[model samples]
Target: MNPTKNSKRKTGRVFDPDATFLSNHPRLSIMILLFLYTVFLIVPSLLYTLFVTPIFYATHLYLLHIINFFSVAILWSIIVPLVLGLPNKREFIEYAKDIKIARIKPVLRSIGLGIITAFITLTCMLFANFLSSLLTGGQVQFVPQLLIHPGTTNIYTSLLLGIWEEVAFRGVMLVLILKIRSKRFSIISNGLLFGAFHSVNILSGFLGAILFGVEYNREHFIPVLFQIVYTAMLGTFLAYMFVKTKMLLPCIIAHYLIDALNTLVILNTEQLNWAYFCFMTFVGIGFLPMIINIPLVRSFSFWFPEPDDEIIPFFDTFLVRKQRLKQYKSDIRSA
Candidate 1:
């Protein structure tokens, strides 16, 4: 084939959404359109809340899992490419490379961090319980009934759920939002989404979600355990570690450990009593890193990540967004 003939031939791959009818802010439109994907997770959950258990009794169908399965599909297959709009196979390949999926160093480091993260979370919670007992005369019992046996099925399911939730929220959703929004915006919004990911307005979830938002400006993404001022502060530390090292595997590891153990804790909450919750209210000191890095944090606000001095070659989701942002700027200019 002649070069000229081949050049003229159209591969016809890109979606190339028509720009003529779009508003002045095409990117905003894309953002809003992508936001609707939340409904895919939410509505099914609402249905489950309303009818799943009763229907199971009536028809004996394992219908509850449908919501879970759909949630996974929406996160991986749909939301992962929510903004790209019909990109070809090559585009996705490039995207994976851009996100540093091929890089192994940070991942290994993240795994290591995860081990430490679990201990940190456990210490915080246990210390909270201990303090609660000392301050308010609360009975801290190692009651066998309180600690549910860690069944294999339950552990596996919880771990699997943790991985999926991380992949969806931090992995895909964070990357997508970073394209058009600032890093802080991406972190905060996704953190809130992380909180709301439970399909309800849970306070601890909300705190946990925002905990990591403060670290994005440094161009690192972190994952962590739980909520409240106590959980939030702990989350802040976990997020800070990820940002400093540009490793995420640790966060994911920390996530499942916290989730699995926390489930046992939640069940035994009443036994430990409300005094325990009140005891945990004294707050945690996880944000000491920021205080130590105080000068850097002075100019920063809640959503902004404190800038760090170290320059590292590690590539993670934040870098992926930087690439996307660069590309978006080019598109906006051309338009």
Candidate 2:
């Protein structure tokens, strides 16, 4: 044997030494798992709120509160971890140890990005509103119900929902998809899915979704803190962070801050001046930078290197090797 070839073989480590259990077609598995999980998590929660909670609570508000708590507990504690095979508490703690919180630059960059992204998001909304008005041939009337409802309670609720949604969609789903496809593919796919998920809103959901997709795709800065702050910008940033960092804590914190801020804004409309509204509108349009530059960025392609391909499938490979090793050991024992 050639000495160089022998040395190279000796230097190489075993792939997926832990023998983690993963699917061969990981992307398909993840999509299927997510769909099934959503059905299982949502149906029961909805039924409980509609049929069971209402019996006791009576009012829609009270019933909604009950459902919220129930969904949180079931989804966070039971469903997410068990069904999805998500990181356990112990594993999360270990992962946190590896994370260096001192890397605050990304977080700061994310704050900037958030502000710009928010501006762009607002701009899109205004643009959409204008388009909607032109199509209708009338001035768009602002419904007081839309404005007045969901006070402090709504803000807190939105924060919680934002965090959970980010963790599940971006953290779990996006990360899982990255295990099978390219990082770019994972980000865009997750972003589109995240955006589509928001279509239920009817008013700003589509625009919001597209913006969120963009945020997920751009992962140059620190994935953890930066992504979370970005999430604060439009509620979709944390989802983006989840995909980039594959961590939950920062995403939750960023989500909480953004929601809390929105809640404050929503609750204090009387205090807001025309300038504030104008500023928000301007910021919403900030996403245009990313939108226009995306093609150029893809063509340049420096942030993500090709060598990361093997590492991209880390989780999937671990699972397959683990299963194979177990089977091999069993066979040996039997022989």
Candidate 3:
């Protein structure tokens, strides 16, 4: 029996479907746009920071600081979003439909997940720091800074870094790549990209990025809120916000809060205790709700009926036949 002539079986799902590509080529158009925009914004700003800023700062440090601050804000709030389509309002609202607070339960549930995620993240970081110390012959350092100091260059730098990174990795890269691939593939690819992008910070940043990717894929709401608790925790949070809220605004806000807190804490304190351990433990306990909800997430797959045992004509567009079991039941009830 010819497979194409068979009336019952459904067509094979597209792995890397032709429709996935915007153009008839290997490179996705959006990826190209992202690369170009990154170069255009980053190169000139770096040049100004290294070369031009020095000339002015040699004469007046205060003026130099002001210029750098404004430069960062402009880059984050204006330049990046304009160049890349981020924080799509329509997409954000649609994704938000999945989230609703009928009672306090959902909110509490999300908060619990946030807590668990925070604990796991801190535990991982501690282990990573210990390993690094053993390998590098240096004192292991794992501190959490909780606030940004007023009138400091570090604040601006952190802000710009957070904003640009969220825009690039979550808003642009993840969205564009996912548009061309399956959800699972896109999630994994985005996770890898998230981790690789932080290579400059070595193992600590890399590990952090991976966790962020995992949390983002698991639950989209609490991650954003969780990110506001710490700057180092921003990656996963922002990514989740991008996925769930589909808006860059929440991401930007989350990133800002995290970085601002870090800047404040680092400037005032010389050392931080392992209260991070306790914090993570508390958060990990909170993630219990999501752990319980896993079965529910899986159960959604069985709601659809099996496809009919007949070959269907291709209508130029791929369309899955709607399962009419509920409607059929309603009609029978009426009769």
Candidate 4:
């Protein structure tokens, strides 16, 4: 079937089918996108776990960190784009063009925002640690991590991750979702999938993803830096940077800085406990808009005695309006 020709408008729900790229074959588009991302992630992981790790273990030629770097670059960046871009060469070419650092204005803005977020993150960490220490009667102690691995491991790995992860998640996966579904669907799916992709820090990842989506929507998805502090999380900050600048440089730099900061911190049980609590708090705050977004949630909407306005009506556009008009006309004809 000619999916485009047969595309039908959607109404009465968060997901509007008609506004999507492949509205008539939503399922197929979703399957393809998921399959591509899955293959990219799985192939690299398998190659590392099965081949590279064993070779490193036996020969000790290269370290685990190097292996991880190559694996992520190959699977996440090199392989995924090559494999996915093959059939849709022209589309990818255009995507490559659109995905870049745009200009001086947004780049400066994003970098500043990233620095602020880093400071905020640091403050959050110290505050949480102090509160935890108080509760634990000053039992907390910073156990220095043995620098057994290569000293440059975190630096290189973080740099690689910042670059490739943005390329993979924001450049490739998010674009794929936007093409297949409405902006809301794309942002939500992109955010959730991005979180799931990390898997190491699922809650933080999820919160970061949602914040990224919200920022993109807030900016009207025009790739503009509309706000200074979009979302406080490092990952979300990266995503917002991408949206504003349309360039990966700011995102990569910010992302690397955030992860690189991790090298400076010491790990402890009490700190983790308080950090987790804080993480939950941030996520809860991010989702608070849902009180008005979802009518059901508004039933007992906590802070807002009167929910001010709709959360994200950004998805509504001329295309959706036209589709709705067509549907209205069709309904009258049927009657």
The whole-model lDDT of each prediction reads 0.45, 0.43, 0.40, 0.45
Off by over 4 Å in 1: 1-38, 48-66, 82-90, 95-102, 106-108, 141-154, 176-199, 202-242, 265-275, 278-335
Mind giving the per-residue lDDT tens digits that candidate 1 earns over 203-290?
2234334542333321111122222344444444433433344434555677677656643432133343445544443432233322
Model 3, position 297, has a per-residue lDDT of 27
TM-score of each: 0.52, 0.50, 0.42, 0.52
lDDT per residue, candidate 3, 245-303, as tens digits? 33454445444543443322221223332333333323321233223323332342233
Residue-level lDDT of model 2, residues 142-191, one tens digit each, is 44343225423454466555556655665556555655555655566666
Better model by lDDT: candidate 1 vs candidate 2 = 1
Per-model RMSD to reference: 14.5, 13.0, 14.8, 15.7
Instruction: Report the C-alpha lDDT of model 4 over 1-335, residue by residue, as the tens digit.
Output: 87775574333233444233332343454457556555554455445445544445445423555655666666544444345442123232333443442222333544664455445554555454556555555443443352233443355556666667777666655555444455555555555555545433333233435533433232232211211111223334344444534455555665566456544444355322443344323432123222222332123123222221212233224336767999999999999
Residue 315, model 4: lDDT of: 27
Candidate 1 residue 133 Cα shift, in angstroms, is 2.9
- State which candidate, 1 or 3, has the greater lDDT: 1
Collision pairs in model 4: 100-246, 100-247, 101-247
> Model 2, stretches more than 4 Å misplaced?
1-25, 49-58, 69-73, 77-79, 82-84, 87-90, 94-112, 141-154, 195-335
TM-score ranking from best to worst? 4, 1, 2, 3
